[model samples]
Target: AVPEAADVDFSDVAGGAWLMDHIPWTEASHRIGALNATAEIARVLRIAMGEAVLSVERHTWRLNEGVTQVWQYFPADLYHLSARFTPNQGPHDQQAETHQQARPTDSQGG
Candidate 1:
């Protein structure tokens, strides 16, 4: 069964085909009932895709026009998340060596 739409937990998102399954939902109208259904569907997507991005299919049968449409991309790569980390290296503590330490030549060292 689907969970509520209040609190969205992305970690529990399972990788699968959410759109293919819940697109033809009969209650996708502008009414309150339809709004609730849309919210539920979004919550599910957040869990399954592990991403809270909006994805609307513009080239579909009914849904068209360049509007907001939430869809799944993939598991979030910690490195790709610019919000938490920079592209320099790993976490804040683990940093990449900017330059190799100067080494002595064969004849320079005994």
Candidate 2:
């Protein structure tokens, strides 16, 4: 997913402006269902925030505040399956030539 222009700014007003680009809940729901069957959707959602990720189970449902809570048929077996939000370290910092170079003479005891 491409980074949304709004995500680059941290100001409240700037961030709030992004609400206008919010995907329709109905459409997200459909996509979630379709994704559950074929993809690891949590990774896709991570692109938007670039910080937090969203995870969901096929049996889960959205309850409120864009939050999805797990639903168990048995009351005694009720449990909460929450999303694990992990911060991304952006891209790795490395040069192609660094990896291609062999060990130096010092390390090789030459």
Candidate 3:
């Protein structure tokens, strides 16, 4: 996971799971699209793309403030994507919200 890396220190966190579990992420936005292997992604993922690849970009917020951003890439032939959204409740539940699930697939099966 690529973090904003501004004021974050991961030395105390054992792994991504632990970090995520400890933080109360209130909101997040995602963009899923086909990208022909952008230069930065190509260099980072170390693959030469002959066709458009799947790119998932996400930005998460804590208490309505931006916290982290992450990007993931996958070959469309190898994977499918799914997401679930639930609004934060309890002290932050000022408005009613709906639960949503999104499943995106290509030629590959989930």
lDDT of 1: 0.33
Clashes by residue pair, model 1: 13-47, 13-48, 14-48, 54-69, 54-70, 55-69, 55-70, 56-69
For model 3, the stretches where C-alpha displacement exceeds 4 angstroms are: 1-15, 81-110
Tens digits of per-residue lDDT for model 2 on 1-110? Answer: 22454356556454324533543122123112111211333344322222332233322122333522342121111222324333653334321220122323566584
Q: Which ten residues in a row have the lowest lDDT in candidate 1?
A: 28-37
How many pairs in model 3 have backbone atoms within 3 A of each other, for residues 3 or more apart or on separate chains, i.e. clashes? 0
Ranking by TM-score, best first? 3, 2, 1
TM per model?
Answer: 0.16, 0.17, 0.51
Query: For model 3, where is the 10-residue window of minimal lDDT?
Result: 92-101
Candidate with better lDDT, 1 vs 2: 1
Residue-wise C-alpha lDDT for candidate 3, range 58-92, written one tens digit per residue: 98887877767888876555555554446654644
lDDT of 1 by residue, 1-110 (tens): 23332254445753223433543332232111111224455465333323433332222332432222333222122112213346676555553322223333477462
lDDT of 1 at 60: 30
lDDT of each: 0.33, 0.30, 0.63
Extract clashing residue pairs from model 3: none
Regions of model 1 farther than 4 Å from truth: 1-3, 14-24, 27-68, 71-110
Q: Comparing 2 and 3 by lDDT, which wins?
A: 3
**Cα misplacement distance, residue 11 of candidate 3 (Å):** 7.2
Candidate 2: segments with Cα more than 4 A from true spot: 1-8, 11-17, 21-26, 30-54, 57-110
Clashes of 1: 8
Candidate 2 TM-score, true structure as reference: 0.17
